[model samples]
Target: MIKKLLPFIGEYKLETILAPVMITIEVALELMIPFMMARIVDYGILGDGGMTYTIQMGSLMVLMAIIALIFGALSGRYAAIAGMGFAKNIREGLFKKIQTYSFANVDKFTTASLVTRLTTDVTNTQNSFMMVIRMAVRAPVMLIGATIMAVSINPQLSTVFIFSIPVLGTALYLIGKFAHPRFLDMLEKYDSLNEKVQDFIVNIRVVKAFVREDHEEEKFVDNAKRVKDAQLNAEKLVVLNMPIMQMTIYTSVVAILWFGGNMVIEGTFNIGELSSFIMYIMQVLISLMMLSMVFIMLIISRASFSRIVEGLEEKPVLDDGDADPQLKPENGDIEFKDVSFSYSDDAEHAVLNHVNLSIKSGETVGIIGGTGSSKSTLVQLIPRLYDVQSGEVHVAGRNVTQYKLNTLRDHVAMVLQNNVLFTGTIKENLKWGNEEATDEEVIEAAKAAQAHDFITAFPDGYDTELGQGGVNVSGGQKQRLTIARALLKQPKIVILDDSTSAVDTATDAAIREVFREHLNDVTTLIIAQRITSVSDADKIIVLEDGKINGFDTHDNLLKSNTIYQEIYESQSKGGGINE
Candidate 1:
């Protein structure tokens, strides 16, 4: 697991190496302080060597302390650099990988789960990396070095460790063993909590409209309580680690004082040497406590790292990397050959079934279907948003899979059913379709989308800033702006998937007129529920039960296609899309 994370360390390799080296130096110098104190007490103050020797040893100890402090500070700085740098790299890597994922890939993980992995999971893993580089080096070095020095001073006194060490070790092993799974459970609860919060925020207006604040609050309380319970279950075991280590430490100290007191009475163990031995024993116990802390943190971070690794290592379900980069769509013509698609692999569960359709360049085609008839699903295949489970989608003259994704998608622009806008100025949002679009081109597309008149009414005009998802705009205005943005692409193929539904019929007619007159070389596909929206199209397609029931001119469809006649009559009785 640790090996998988190492690559993200990348340019931080220098800091990673330096942090441990600094910790080693700091530990070595700290160990010498007790030895120096012993010399000052035993030889300078008590032995024939007098005040002058004591002063010399004390000065040397102060100098070593200063050096150790410097090294310790340096180690902390390096660890911070390495840990933070590692986290930044992983975040960028995860986002980059996600961008390559097809719609099917994104469907595998929810938006909330991905956000938690990027934020909470990455933070936990970074802290573990810092602890390992700093405390991980300090604890074991302190333990081994203190043990060796204590043995040299009095080997018989060191025998106290033979009893105490095993007891502390056994307690820690049990704590870690039980605590790991609980931490995993706690992390799962965090994902759920984040999902709940995210869903509420995205739909806050809906909640208020329905007057369901109290119900939503009660659900939040339940989720928070689950998180608290899971945390306490794991933390209860981890808390045992400290009390057991403290008990072992205090027991060893009392036993040492009793045995060393007798040796002092017999004048065998020097008083100064006994003091230093006790100090070394304290260091050993404290180091053991630190080591235990490092292990506990690792247990917590292990779950977080696994989630991050799972996201990082997920293979995007779509790949066009090996396709010909130079292959370009020559015309707007599109063809579907016996295509079948399912969100799942089960062919019987398909949303689009055995579909065959061919659209000529510059033709305006309307697709009408009842709900769940797969009108949107059919158009999505042209740009390869999701691959067909069987058969092929052809653009221009070649199968879509033969062209690089960027090349294929660049020439096919879609204004999706859900219009999304980022936080930016009007100009900035429009430029998403064509980053290099000039001011003249921007105005022309807006005019063609019937957005220029309303946009100019604002004081800021093209420079007006939009809120997230363009909350400031009316539904009809948002739809027009998205249409303008898509038009800026100057794509060979344009798809409006119920995109203009919010616009008034008059404006909808004007936008269609613009497409008919101006986009003479571009193939246009309009998916609409209103029969009037597609009534004047060069051709109309009627879909039913995931298959093409009829594909012909609108006049012929009204006479022959029963599905089309039924939809037309139902909407006619309802007075059309205005409802």
Candidate 2:
């Protein structure tokens, strides 16, 4: 994990290096102070030549104190720079890597989980890095340095450090070892808490409409309580560290006072030497306390670090680097030959199986299927959103995987069933299809998608600020806006995956008419549940149980295909068929 995180230190390498160096110097200067004060006491205060030596030693001590303060300040500044910079790099790298994930890759993790890893996990790791650079360097140096000084001053009293150090070390090690697993549990509970919050907020309207606020609140409280319980469990172990540290500190201090006071009385140690030894004992114990805190931080951050590394090192399922960049989807010709696919690798059956079909450029194809018939799954494969387990999907005379992913997707525009829209002006959202599109071009695409009239009805017109996910608009309006965005791309192939479901039949027909007139050269694929939506298509595909039950012109299928005949008869009797 340390190796994985080191590279994120990138441009801050100098700050990371300098922080520890400055801290080490500060510790060294701090160790010198107690020894200097000892000399000031024995030779300057208690000796025959009193005033002159006292003044000189006091001046030296003041100089050392000032230098130590400066080192301490520099170390803090450098640690902050290194910690913040490292975190920024990791966040950027995580986001960029997520952008490269295929649909299958994205399906492995949830949005809430990823958000937590990027924010909470990265923050924990950053804090741990800062503490490691500063206290980690200072504490060990102080411990060893103060130990040597105390031994040199009076080895007999220094025996307290030897006993206290080992005891504190054993206690801290046990606390950290026991607390680590609990901390890991606490972090996982945090991920669940974030997930619940996100889900509740995103679906708040549904909760209100269904009068399920009480249920959601109960769920939220339960999740919150779980987080609290897990935290307390982890903290219960950590709380042991401070008490153990305080006990060691007090024990060492008392032991030094007793033995050293006796030595001073016996003339084996001077009063100045005994005083310095007591100060050294305090420094040693305090350094041990600092080291214990560092260990505790490492225990908490270990889980967060592992989560971050999983996101960073996740290999993308699809990569276009091996594809020929020169190859591109020139036209909208599509073919599926013996293609079989499943959402899971070891599923009992494919969601789409043995599918063989073909469509030429400029043709309008309509697909009708039951809820789980995999119509959207079929269209997603055209852009290589997910790869086939066997056989192949071909577009524009080459395998879909042969063309660079960007090249293939650039030519294919899909307005998904969800009809997602960002929180931006109407024109701004449309520009996602073509970032360089002018105002006129955006208007033209909206007009083509039958969205211009409703957009202009708003007071702000094209510049209206949309709520998140276009919440302010009606469902039909959101669908139209998404269609407009996809049309703005002007791709050779356009797939509407039940995108017009919310619009009335008249409006749906108008949108289809506009497609026929303006997109004469673009291949269009429409998936609809209503018979009227596809009755006039150049070809209508009827999918049943992952197989093509019918594939032909609507009129031809009405006479021959059993599934098509039954659907046409039902819709016609219901007065819903268009033609």
Candidate 3:
């Protein structure tokens, strides 16, 4: 995992390298200061050397301290640069990877999980990387340097740290082992918490309409409590670290003071040496404490790193492969040859069966299906949003997989069942269909969609800012706006999946007229629940339980197909048809 992340450290390579080098220099200077203090006490202050020698050593100590401070500050600055830069690159790379994922790939991960990985997980890894380069290097180096000095001064007193070090190390290892999995579990709980919040906020209007505010609040509190419980469980093991460190640190300190004091009185140890020995013991033990903190951070960061890498390493389910790069979609003619698909590979049955159908360019066909009849799934294959399991889906005289994904999708425009508009001006949102569209072109497309008059009635007209998801617009208006946007693409194939469900029959009829007038040459597929919506199509396909129960015009279907006859009769009672 570390090796994979190393490449993204790219431009920050110098900062990453310099951080540890500067930290090492700072540690060296720090170690020298203690030794210099020993000299000032033993020879300059207590023994024959006196004031002149003391002043010289003191001046040198101050210089080393200043250098150490400068090095410490530089290491911190470089560590921040490297850590933040690495995170920025990872975020960009992760988003790009997500953009490449097919719909099936997106189904494997939730929105909340991805958001958590991009934000909180990345932050955790960044902080860990910074500490790893700075304190991580300094801790071990200081421990080793302090141990060497202490042992040389007097091995007997130093043995106290030797005994204490292993015990603290063992405790820290156990804490990390017990806490690592819990931390991973905690992160999962955080994902759930975020999901609950997102779900509630996105559906806030629905909640209010249903008077379910109390219910939503309870749901949010339950998710938040789950997160708190998971976090507390992980921290239970981590909290042991502090108590163990305190006991070991104080025990080692008392042992050194006792042993060094007796040795000094016994004439084997000098006062300066004893003082330096105590300082070295403090350094060694404090370094161990810092190391334990790093250990805990590593445990959390390891979990976050694994989650991030999971996203980055995922292979896109659909790849254009080594197909002829020059191959391009030429027209909107579509064919499904014995095609079958299931969202999951292990599903007991396919959402689409061995269906064979062909539509010539410029033909407008209507598809009607009962619930769970895979109406959306059937058309999704045209643009290769999902690959067929057993057979082929061809567009423009070539298998969709042979063309570049962007090239195939560019020529096939879909207005999905759920009409979505972004948070932008109406013109900006429409520009998504064709970035180069002019104001006149935009007006024309909206006029074709029967959306221009109402749009002009708005105070800002084309410049009206839409709330997120176009919440500011009526449902019928939002649908018409989406239709206008899709029309602006001027694609050879247009798929409207229940795209007129919200519009009144009059507006629906007018929009169909516009389709006949302006988009007559483009191959169009309409999926609708109402029989009247498809009554006038060139052909109508009736699907039942993933199979084509009937394929004919409305009048022929009502005469021959039982399923179509039932649907037509039901909608007829509701006065759905005009003629």
- TM-score of candidate 3 on Cα atoms, chains taken together: 0.96
* Residues forming the 10-long window of minimal summed lDDT in candidate 1: 570-579
Clashes of 2: 0
TM-scores, all models, native as reference? 0.97, 0.96, 0.96
Q: Tell me the spans in candidate 1 whose CA falls farther than 4 Å from its real position.
A: 577-579
State the lDDT of candidate 2 residue by residue for 1-579, as single tens digits.
Answer: 888889999999999999999999988999999998988898889886589988888898999999999999999999999999999999999999999999888788788788988999999999999999999989999989999999988887777768877788788789888888998899889989999999999899999999999999999999999999999999999999999899888887888888888887888889988888888888888889999999999999998999889998899888788899898788999999998988889646788889999999999999997789889998999988899887899998889888989888989999999889999999999999999998999999999888999999999999999999889999999999899999988899999999999999989999999999999899999999898888889999999888888899988998899988887788889987755
Which pairs of residues clash in candidate 3, taking residues 3 or more apart in a chain or in different chains? none
In candidate 1 the C-alpha lDDT for residue 565 amounts to 88
What does candidate 1 score on TM? 0.97
Q: Which residue pairs does candidate 2 place in steric collision?
A: none
Please provide, for model 3 over 263-315, each residue's C-alpha lDDT reduced to its tens digit, 9 standing for 90 to 100.
89999999998988889889998999999999989887888999999999999
